[model samples]
Target: MDQNSAKEGKGLSIIAYITIIGVLIAFFMNQEKKNSFTFFHIRQSLGLWLMYFIFGYVISGFDSWMLTYSFWIFFAVLFLYGLLGAISGKANSIPILGDFFQKLFKSLGN
Candidate 1:
């Protein structure tokens, strides 16, 4: 991305990490600026966040404490990866689901 585009998209990019609220803010913010790279990361972050809640709910049902803790730990790792991508201005996917999110939300931007 060029400097101008990066500058324009910086607000949305930063907003893309505050969980679900950030997702909504980024989406609306991107509407005017419309940076593809920033949009890609926003969509990817949204998917990861949505999955995080789903996984949290599923894990909560498990009776085993160890399993619950492990699940949350894994989610934290993924969240960190997504955050790093947003901060670094790269659409780097979180290990297992990065490509999947890119494909899933491809229509939103491209």
Candidate 2:
């Protein structure tokens, strides 16, 4: 998609990834006008945030530099991947977990 068409849903797409509150706001924002691009991002961001919490709890016991950095880098990359896609107006799923997220949140985003 070109920049112009991408611009339409970029705002809500980025907003959905900002925070939990932002996700809810973006959800409602796109309720009236459903933008597939924004919805795709919302699903990805929601999946990322949910995984962040799940991993946080699971990794709390493992105190190691390798684990620490790996965890941070993994999520960071995922976040950046989605954010950049949104900025560029692309509907690319994050990477590994993206497709699953899209499927999981399909009902809501649609």
lDDT of 1 by residue, 1-110 (tens): 66666566766876787779989988887787679777877877888788988988888888999998888788788878777766766656778898888888888865
RMSD of 2: 1.8
Q: Please provide TM-scores, in order, for all candidate models, with all chains considered together.
A: 0.86, 0.90
Q: Which stretches of candidate 2 lie over 4 Å from their true place?
A: 1-5
User: What's the lDDT for all of these models?
Assistant: 0.79, 0.86
Candidate 2: tens digits of C-alpha lDDT, residues 17-57: 88878888988999987877888888999999999989978
Task: Highest lDDT: give the candidate number.
Answer: 2
Question: Against the true structure, whose TM-score is highest?
Answer: 2
The reply for model 1, stretches above 4 Å from the true place, is: 1-4
